[model samples]
Target: MTVNTRELSTIESTILAYFQALNDADIESILDLYSEDPVMLPFLQPAVVGANAVRANYESTFQLIRFEVQTTIQELVEMSPEWAYVRTDTSGIFTPIRTGEGAPAAFHELFLLRKMGNEHWQIARYSFSPAGALPPI
Candidate 1:
């Protein structure tokens, strides 16, 4: 659906906030942006729904990683009042399991979000691809 100028701006900021939060690695702030029943489409995995589940997913992954996972936004598109998308190029050291220092990897992700309630936007879908190996961090 078409959104007016003001709401459009809000959605745009919300989409941009995704990358901003990731870059900042402020998990609390990111969590505040989500709805109680939001959905998440993580890479090569089953869909995760609800704020609690979404937080759990990230918390589990973050704990395994020796270092933090960060992201940078490459492109973003807000197509409608309830729909928007972001493409991010990411690079960070991550550990799938507990170990010393895990290897660093580079990847890109496309996130699709939907606005819920009266004013909050939450991730509804996403797809990810490994771009290539990144420089050692």
Candidate 2:
């Protein structure tokens, strides 16, 4: 069956917008998609807390590399209308502007989302790691 864009939930739309913002490197728009107390756990990096830190993280990141990535929402579980979590897998090329080289990039991400005061969904906690092999289960 065909999916109707108009019928998409706020969380779904927000996640889509988030990926677009990432590709665009629109820091302002990226920050707009986060909650007041935002948290990010980037790959091989310490936890980044607060809006300012997140901003810095993205700033430094964009300076080093640019992502031409496509993100797929693997699963979306709604705990309620106010809270949810989205699992996603992103894969594409990550190009380091300094070297002008692009490499295969893949990651698995999780977003802990909540409805803000404006009744808009925003990410409160987000974490991602390399998508390849990990410790055996």
> What are the per-residue Cα lDDT tens digits for candidate 1 across 66-131?
434567777767787667877888777655554465677777888777786676777676567667
Q: Over the full model, what C-alpha lDDT does candidate 2 score relative to the true structure?
A: 0.85
For candidate 2, the per-residue lDDT at 135 reads 24
Clashing pairs in 2: none
In model 1, pairs of residues that clash are none
TM-score for each of the candidates: 0.66, 0.87
Total backbone collisions for each predicted model = 0, 0
User: Model 1, poorest ten-residue lDDT window?
Assistant: 61-70
Which parts of model 1 are misplaced by more than 4 Å? Answer: 1-16, 23-25, 66-72, 95-97, 116-120, 133-137
Find the candidate with the highest lDDT and give its number: 2
